[model samples]
Target chain A: MGCVRRSERIVRLTRHLVDHPGTALSLTEMAEHYGVAKSSLSEDLAIIRSVFEQDGNGFLRTQLGANGGILFEVDVSTTREQEIMAEILAQLSDPQRILTGGYMFITDVLSQPQILRNVGKMFAKLFAKEEPDVILTVETKGIPLAVITSEYLNIPYVVARRDHNWSEGPSVSTNYVSSFDRRIQSMSLSRRSIVQGARVLILDDFMKAGGTIKGMIALMEEFSATVVGTGVFMATAEPSEKFISSYRSLVTLAHMDEMSGSVVVEPGNYFTERM
Target chain B: MGCVRRSERIVRLTRHLVDHPGTALSLTEMAEHYGVAKSSLSEDLAIIRSVFEQDGNGFLRTQLGANGGILFEVDVSTTREQEIMAEILAQLSDPQRILTGGYMFITDVLSQPQILRNVGKMFAKLFAKEEPDVILTVETKGIPLAVITSEYLNIPYVVARRDHNWSEGPSVSTNYVSSFDRRIQSMSLSRRSIVQGARVLILDDFMKAGGTIKGMIALMEEFSATVVGTGVFMATAEPSEKFISSYRSLVTLAHMDEMSGSVVVEPGNYFTERM
Candidate 1:
């Protein structure tokens, strides 16, 4: 390979780290790939790290161990996170998104790459130290959020299903009461979806009463997996008594008035979790 | 508010384009944001574009008009895509992934961020010219694939539900025959999920007979939307006569010996589409 300039190498390195978030890259390999000296590579990485931190994009972690080299950890600053939450709050407060039930239609926000990326970064940041082996979520709406969070964390995610299909083969099933209607429901996860003793972080787009999250925890238990932490994009505040008390939410739905068509939303525990 | 180095500008520019794929960026705003001259910004963009294309990460598009600017178009090369497909094929070929009813348990692969990102980039590349207004898919398995595709395309996606919930407000419903069991089933999308005359690309994790994609198309028509294209991560080769003739798939399951626990998989129309 031809020798590349520092500017070109930095751009490519930045792209590489961004693409493979939370993945460690060896200096020896990168140096050989770029046909540059190890010292030069280290200096270049330092510059990249400085820019990433100054821009508030993320942190470039370097471990001195033999297996460690460089890892990009996504970090969304509290101020920027608050700004994103405020924007989401405004979107949720739209009257048209109000349904007959207390549900706020946020499919639009969850589907937007820009919004989801930021939200995922926030979740990844909150659980950065958790070093989860995998991410977990129930099927349907939470898929996107879970995917994005795992993407940022550089881990795979597993989805538990409400309906058991014969195509999935043998599976473990668990029953949990629906917090919304207090009805008993069952969710299943394929035996192969998760390995034994894996640490998992639970993520969801919306949480009304935490029934689904509770079910995910129960399902994780079947795999002998440890629940490292839980995060949600939004949660209803009406149910002061949640099935699971230990969880973080990006936004809180304080009040929803169907007759008058009004809604109240505030930044969730995500803001206070750090404190 | 101060002068910035070319290396610094390029790093930030690359991160910006990669983060907001397929979204056009105004050079004026970017230049102002970077505190650089328009000429300098153009030069920086040119360098970034060359490196991106060389790395086979994506393409940086430049438009020159009142509403013109640079746009990042994610493009995974045939060679890179083949490597990704081969990796996925190996994973799927495992007998452990085989389940009853001839279904390959792919929740792990679809939930994998690295693999899903590549698959999503491939879909975005195949339909790059389609300029889909939105991406669509049925809930459960396909949600992650659809979300990743839309993320690469920098657009929002909608999920159709197998069953409707009052929390979604008004929705449009359609019934289609299941290609696997040849059974009739109903799927619905929120009324606001899609708008009139929108261009949509359907995405899914696996396609047996493409009944789900067909149902999605029918639902899109109710909203007066056009189905520009459809893509799937994997599709079975059985039932040679597919319900939909115009679609793309990454991997094809040519055969499966359930008793012997052997399987055959190869690149799908995704390879032939370019030809």
Candidate 2:
């Protein structure tokens, strides 16, 4: 890189960590790339780590061993997380989001890349502690959220398709009832997508009765994968009892009135799960 | 963000710009955030900008107006881009990816976060010049690619679903013949996802005969949007002529023999589109 000055080195080092979140960068290799000594690189990393802490952007973790290296962990500050949730709550509370069946339309919110990115950061910050090997989500809306969360956590994600494409080779699928329509629908995942005994984190954009999430859990079972944790952008408060007993949501859709064009939202179980 | 020291301020400033690519950061606001003088902040930015140049990671452009400020433009170097494309070629040539009916099973590859991220960088670098207001992709496989590209370009994206979901409120749909099966199938997008007269770029994971891409262009027309460009991950060589005349692809699928598990791939029009 030929970045000699301390401030220059700090900027490059910080950019590397920022680009590859959750992935470890070999300190020895980094030193070589910067044409600096190991001790010098270590000092540079210290400055970068402290900057991360002071800014409350995230935290850095360094491991010592053969396969060990420096890693950047995504951690959203409590105040910033609250702000993100409040923003999402406001978007969801828009009366125009109320649909014909009182179903709150959220496609617009998820379509905005910035909102999707921030939402991913929140989910990643909350579920990263689980150390899931991979993320799993159903197709359609969940794909973007899963992709962003995977980016933040530096983990690979597999999307379970709404149907099995035979051209895709053999697939493992399970039928589940759709709470939104009260009908049976099948979801599928490629047989090679996940290996056996992998720790999995299931994420989705929204949940009502958790039928889709529950279906994903079952699909994970087919691969003999462990469901370490589950996260959702929002869930219905009325589904007090859901198909799945375990999951953390960022916001709760408390009430909706199509005729009056009213929608209500509150902090989800995320409050209880995280602080 | 009370970053006092020069290295510390550089680290935090670089982090914010890295987090928000294509979005301008006002120097006055950044100066206030770091509790530093405007002159000092500008000096710090110069250092950061030079570092970014030295690393060939990207470029920083500063605007001189009210709605203008410093912005990071994602630029993948020629050497790094070649490496990325070569890596993808090797991954795609794996005989195991040859599925039934000579179809390639790339779902597993699109699932990898690192590959997906790099692919996004390449596409963003190629199409960012179009300055498209929003990105468009179809449901299922194309969502992750679009989402990642959206992140790099710092623009919003909308996915057209394979079928209509009334829960999403009113939507616009068009029927197209599926290239894989030659069967008529419909794709849809929420009516409110895009505004009239917006510039759009269409992206997809794979294309054969370009039926779906054609559908997306048609849908854009329905919204009174202009199609600035179209990009695809891979396109089949056998089609020779596709439904869409103007589009770019990263890799060309030369041959796939399911019986012998022999697959071949060539670099796509990305080379011609770039240097």
Best by DockQ: 2
lDDT of 2 by residue, A105-190 (tens): 88778777778888899888888888899999998788888999999998899888897877578889998988988899999988
Off-target runs (Cα >4 Å) in candidate 2 are A1-4, B1-4
The true-versus-predicted C-alpha distance at residue B217 of model 2, in Å, is: 0.8
| Ten residues in sequence with the least summed lDDT for candidate 1 chain A | A1-10
TM-score of every model versus the real structure:
0.96, 0.97
What TM value does the first chain of each candidate achieve?
Answer: 0.95, 0.95
lDDT of each candidate versus the true structure? 0.85, 0.87
In CAPRI terms, where does candidate 1 land?
Answer: medium
Clashing residue pairs in candidate 2 are: none
Cα deviation of B209, candidate 2, in Å: 0.9
lDDT of 1 at B191: 90
